[model samples]
Target: MTRSEATASTTGTPEADEYDVIVIGAGPVGENVAERAHANGLSAVVVETELVGGECSYWACMPSKALLRPMAALADARRVEGASQAVRGSLDADAVLARRTAFTSDWQDGGQVDWLDSVAVDLRRGRARLDGPRRVKIEAPDGSTHTLTARHAVAVCTGSRAALPDLPGIEEARPWTSREATASKEVPGRLAVVGGGVVGAEMAVAWRALGAEVTMLVRGERLLPRMEPFAGELVAEALTEAGAEVRTGVSVESLRRPSTDRPVTLALSDGGQLEADEVLFATGRRPRTEDLGLETVGCEPGSWLTVDDTCRVKDVHGGWLYAVGDANGRALLTHQGKYQARIAGAAIGARAAGVPLLETDRWGAHAATADHEAVPQVVFTDPEAASVGLTAEDAERRGLRVRAVDLEMGEVAGAALYADGYRGRARMVVDLDREVLVGVTFVGPGVSELLHSATVAVAGEVPVERLWHAVPSYPTISEVWLRLLETYRG
Candidate 1:
């Protein structure tokens, strides 16, 4: 009679034993795909090796952001309570790790399995490997083998895995990647970061704030090369202020164990070397598509499965297979992966149910999407940096009419009130022809919270004129938006 009652299905119970759709990798995207498929009246089963929620829920974004969030919360507390005794304290490593463990459900898979059962999506606990078209072979933890045949389609949502660089003895170093780095309990006395990308920069700041002497060896010119130059400059300033020694335009020549008790020494391409108790290789990641029996499916080694604009995995023999998320290399982000999964799920359901699926020329339901146009990104370092869409340099290379506006963040009222000695920058790129917001970069303390506002404006294609009307509150860091618009007009 009610929506809740209607959703309460037999599929969740053991009564609904067989499933029409079997999803490999029960990460967030996998769950999303399963849910979407279920909504389309197909029985869905989600197989997961670990927790149901995946990396963002436990290790990657959640834990990293959790460690960084205390600083943010403390800032808020200090701002609200001038007396300071109301929230007088520092981080307790044990307590934080305990909380993280609780959030991750303590590496136990039963709760997630129960959730899948309640949601009417079958939960299979196993390491899933793709066997062939519309098929998966799973090795359950209980020493049992099972096979699942997906009649509709198979969706791959295996998130990316850490990639170690080719440095002599680097592999032998037994260093921490994002997995160990984010889930670490104790902060090392000295930490050396090997990459300059998002994870490296963010973790460097987080650990440094937690009292680790951090030095970042980046092979790029700026801290976050993916952001605007102005934004990157602000992030670099933030890292330096927090006492992080960032050396750019350098590569790792060699890594070696100095002693059994001491830290490792990393030799650089610039004929310099540094030692730290901990070494983190955040160079990059590749799709976790290896050993999934893709060879049996005839997929290439070098590249990911070839999926169409609709997320239909292409092949010479046939075109029934599909891949999404990190496996597609479309966007190795949780949200983007989930977005692709939704499209793939909907497409499969529509085709199976013989419904004429509505298609769009660009972003909308039923498109693989996220190619072309803008995708928002944020680096959660102190004096944070956030950006969406193409920078002026990228736009020029792509042959777009771009007009850029740059301003020191200190010029805004928000920056002044944020702190007496504020340090950061704000920049925006506008499409001169379309008069729409293309990209925005906000850098400075307490600015990571401001990203979604700009993201909404850009994704909605809010015109610069309309954006001007969308007023940011006064005496807040967001007032930088007004200053930016004024600069653009002038």
Candidate 2:
């Protein structure tokens, strides 16, 4: 059968179909929007060109964590005296690669397809673009087209892509984006990573542990410039200790690779050249809005869509258009994207049912309050760094009356017991005027699990006095919370 005919029989014909909500992109954000809209009695359909699970499920988060977990486990084993003696060999690369493949479901989308089916969200496999307000045009793989109309709202959840710098020969070099890095079958002998952000830092740690001679080129003074300075410092120290050559205050002038099989040669801003088996440019991300046909709806084609408290597109006349997740350019993390999806989906349902949006406050159900008040993220590195809300520097720049309470996490008995020589730091940015934590950061082995407590505190805006009653359990890494609180009180 023809592609159009098949689509009509399987997913319903464009002329005969209309949904209350149409979500572009079937990633976690898109999936959540469809699921939540369904929960509110709205008929929703999700259009996707790739795997429904998106980057996190296939390439970015799941695969990367699967690769990092073994390395972390081995490191901890080596740190303890009794376990250190039992360790005698390096990581099994083949086994590690196999586990990573399993975690990503071998890059298949079947599981995610089943999830959408269970949630009663219609799935259309196509590249979707905004044909006009509340109208989406989708191009199928076989060069057929389908038009979908949204009765209530069209949500942009297409997320973002890895951004490469403008440089000659870089594109032809076939450099490793985050996709290739995490899902790589063969480890590069020498890897050059440019950019000091989360991707750069995490990949540097992962590849170096997996036996790649990683050279990190950071244009800034340190890695993770977005986080607190101490967080970056500790990460740099860990990367250096892992035998990765960490270079700061450097830039790539040009790149040259005559063929895909050839090593990539880089000409540095310092008038030096280095060659590597692979080069990953994890500089940043750009919204996947280039081909969304935003111009037809009176929105800029390649720019981010502005959204209000309800995630409703600001400039659209009838407010039928909304943008969520990385496409909104608010918080780029997956969890934050899911949070926005919940808010945007509910808002669409409310509008469809002719119900008023009652609670639009900072922590309200109809508004993505967590995106502004408390966005939590955990960087999976040895001595993992997890943080939520603002850093001290961010609070100062925002002109908020905040005080930073910094302490060594090693002083906590739980941390010391967790590892023979626990080396890490903790910091809390307290809103002195409100007597509550505005931000919190923890960097140490096994510290990623300790982050949600801080997330709850910041999101709930729990007062300092009330927090004192919420005692952390004795003899756990979470005791850092108690230490931070005590330091603040003093």
Q: Write the per-residue lDDT of candidate 2 for residues 123-202, one digit (tens) a residue.
A: 88889988877899999988989788888889999999998888988888888899999999998999999988899888
Model 2 has an lDDT value of 0.88
Top candidate, metric lDDT:
2
Residue 463, candidate 2: Cα error in Å is: 0.7
Per-residue lDDT of 406-451 in model 1, one digit per residue for the tens?
A: 8888788777777656767777888899998777888877887788
Pairs clashing within candidate 2: none
Model 1 regions lying over 4 Å from their true place? 1-18, 75-91, 258-260, 316-318
TM-score of each: 0.90, 0.97
Q: Model 2, 429: alpha-carbon shift in Å?
A: 0.8
